[model samples]
Target: MTIERTEPATDAAERTMLEGWLDYHRNTLAWKCEGLSDEQLRTASVEPSELSLMGLVRHMAEVERGWFRKVLTNEDAPPIYYSDEDQDGEFHLTESDTYQEAFATWQAEIETARRNAARFALDDLSEGKHRRTGEQFNLRWIYTHMIEEYARHNGHADLIRERLDGSTGD
Candidate 1:
């Protein structure tokens, strides 16, 4: 599948700007993983760190679920790939873990995030609070943070992809 990432509009409204950039980053991550084999997707970049393209997809799926479903909508959405006992379960892939499943789950979470965010204005407070500070967050803040999160992870993805196949771009 071709991942066509459009540039965020410069003259758009605040919400459009935010959503555009967020989706851009989302697509960036997807593009990074494009055309790679299952073994390549599962290959780690460096020693010790278990960061892989597939793992990033799974981790982002969890992030989307946590912020959008569990926090924004206050739904009883448990982690699909992780738990308290194994905080980074998504990053720790098994022999059965596949790119198709990880990407499908991530895309599903993104759809749910869009639906949840559509119900609230940017200034609306999240139904759930921060796990660390116990402070509630506005949708604007959530959007901004999610953009940052994806941006950071996408950088890692870029490196991993480069290491895997020497392909590089935004």
Candidate 2:
């Protein structure tokens, strides 16, 4: 079950470049989880930390929903796996959680994010305000931020995957 990742195009427009990098990072995360069982995916192989590949998948789904559906498009979207009471639930998995469900939700959120993003131009302002500062952001800023988020998390994913099975690559 090897996951296939596409390399970003060297020469492209701003949107194409941004999206290509983002998709690359996204697939990189999935690639890290490939060929692992549910328990393997949920293992906190990174000692002294609770981060797992499944947790990263869940976290990214929440991120996609939060930024795209909740903020960008102003949809009444709520956290998929976490709440105010359990803020880190996405990273706190149980035996009941399945990798299939987690991956499906993550993929669905990714698709929704793309659809929601299509409604606005790069310079268009988000319909919702930032939770911390109450300031609005443009779509371009959101895209850049999302790319950064994925890139950072994918690095974590790489470390975790390598620790799990001694596998490593871009």
Candidate 3:
């Protein structure tokens, strides 16, 4: 299915601006993967890299869960697709994974992230520490980091989508 992207407003409050840009990037990822078959979605178009459109969807879902649910809300959310033994599972796809399910899970996680974020002000600090750095952070930092994360992954998505069908755009 095709996903429609809404451009961020040029002028807005800090919260609105952050959320709008994030939503734009999120939709861009979906648009990049839209209307493709399961095989197409799973194609590691950029050889030597394990990245795939489907894997990206899964990765973003995990990212949303981590920053929003786990860090922001201090919820005990586990990884959706990875483990210690398979830390990069989000970028690893098999024939058993379905694009429909990945998209649904990603969308759900997005909604959950929004709900979790709505509970706190931008300056509110997380109760949990960063997994790697062991440093605490605020909601504002999380929002900015998530935007950067999606922006970077969306670039990868653009390349993969183009390789799959020569399609390209914002």
- On lDDT, the stronger of 1 and 2 is 1
Among the numbered candidates, top lDDT falls to 1
| Residue 18 of model 1, lDDT score | 95
Task: Write model 2 residue lDDT over 1-170, tens digit each, in one string.
Answer: 66777876788888888888888888888888989999999999666899999999999999999899878988898889999999999999999999999999999999998898889999999999777788788999999999899989988888888898889987
TM per model?
0.98, 0.96, 0.96
Give the clashing pairs for model 3: none
How would you encode candidate 1's per-residue C-alpha lDDT over 41-130 as one tens digit per residue? 999889899999999999999999999998888899989999899999998988889999999999999999999999999999999886
Which pairs of residues collide in model 2?
Answer: none
Worst 10 residues of 1 by lDDT: 128-137
Model 2 superposed RMSD (Cα): 1.1
Task: Give the CA lDDT, 0 to 100, for residue 74 in model 1.
Answer: 84
lDDT of model 1, residue 67: 94
Tell me the deviation in Å of residue 68 in model 1: 0.4
> Relative to the true structure, how large is the alpha-carbon lDDT of every model?
0.94, 0.90, 0.91
Task: Give the candidates in order of TM-score, highest first.
Answer: 1, 3, 2
- Predicted structure with the largest TM-score when compared to the true one: 1
